[model samples]
Target: LRINDPGIDLGVAAALYSSRLEQPLDSDAVYIGEVGLGGEVRPVSFVESRLKEAEKMGFKQAYLPSPNLPDSAQKKKIALLLSPV
Candidate 1:
C-alpha cells in the first residue's frame, strides 16, 4: 500500500517512540496531524470530517493541529485536544 500523505501518523508514532516503547498512547483517543522531522505537528486536511468519523467510531478524544480545530467545539460530543500554535 502507498501512503501519499507525507506522514499523518507521525504524531502518534513519535509519541509512542518517545515513550521508549514502555508506555502506550490512549486507545480511546484519536490523533490527527502530520509530524515534521523536528517533532512539530503540521495541520492536515479534512480535520472536521476526521474528528466526526472518529467520534462516530467511539473515540471520545482527539489531538489535532491547532489551526485545524473547529469552532463548533462547544457543541461536539467528543473532546478536541487542540495543539498549541
Candidate 2:
C-alpha cells in the first residue's frame, strides 16, 4: 500500500517500504513520479527498459499503471501487473 506523504518521495518510499515489508520488490528499481493526495502512484515515461532491467537483474515481475505498458512490449516475455489507482 502506498501512503501519500508530501515529505517523502514515492520512489524512495516504495523502495524503503518494499524492503521494510519484505515485499517482492526484488531487483526491480522504481521510477516513481509525484505522489497524489489519494495515495496514488503517478507514472513516468516508457517503463519497458525498466521492466527489462528488473527482469535482467533476476526480477520476474513489474508493477505499474496499465497505460504505462509499452505497446510494442504488450506481447513480450515479461510479467507486468497493473494496479489501478
Candidate 3:
C-alpha cells in the first residue's frame, strides 16, 4: 500500500498499525484522512471521488472527515466513519 501522492495519510497509517497490533481491520474498509501532529484526524479534498473510487473497487466502508462527507455518497452502499478533528 504505497501511496505515490504528496499528501499525508496519517489516519490510514495509524489504522494499519492498529490492525497489526490488534485484530485485523475490516478487509472491506478503506481509511482516508490525515492525522495531524497533535493526533487529530483532518479532512482532505476530493473526498467524494475518493470514496466513489473505493466503492468501485468493492470497499464497503470509508473512514473520513465528517465535514468532507458528500450527500451523493450517502446513496452508495459504502458506510462512512465520520471523524471530527
Report lDDT per candidate. Answer: 0.69, 0.56, 0.67
* Top lDDT model: 1
Residue 57, model 1: lDDT of 88
Top-TM-score candidate index: 1
Tens digits of per-residue lDDT for model 3, 1-85? 7876422475467567888899777788777777768766777887777877877888776767667676654645445444433
lDDT of 2 by residue, 26-79 (tens): 453444344667867666554666666656666544556555656654545666
Displacement of the residue 72 alpha carbon in candidate 3, Å = 6.3
The estimated TM-scores of all candidates read 0.72, 0.50, 0.69
- Where model 1 places Cα greater than 4 Å from the true spot, the runs are 11-15, 73-85
Candidate 1, residue 41: lDDT? 81
Supply the global lDDT for candidate 2.
Answer: 0.56
Q: Report backbone clashes per prediction.
A: 0, 0, 0
Query: 2 or 3, which is superior by TM-score?
Result: 3
Candidate 1 structure quality by residue, lDDT tens digits, 33-52: 88878878888887777877
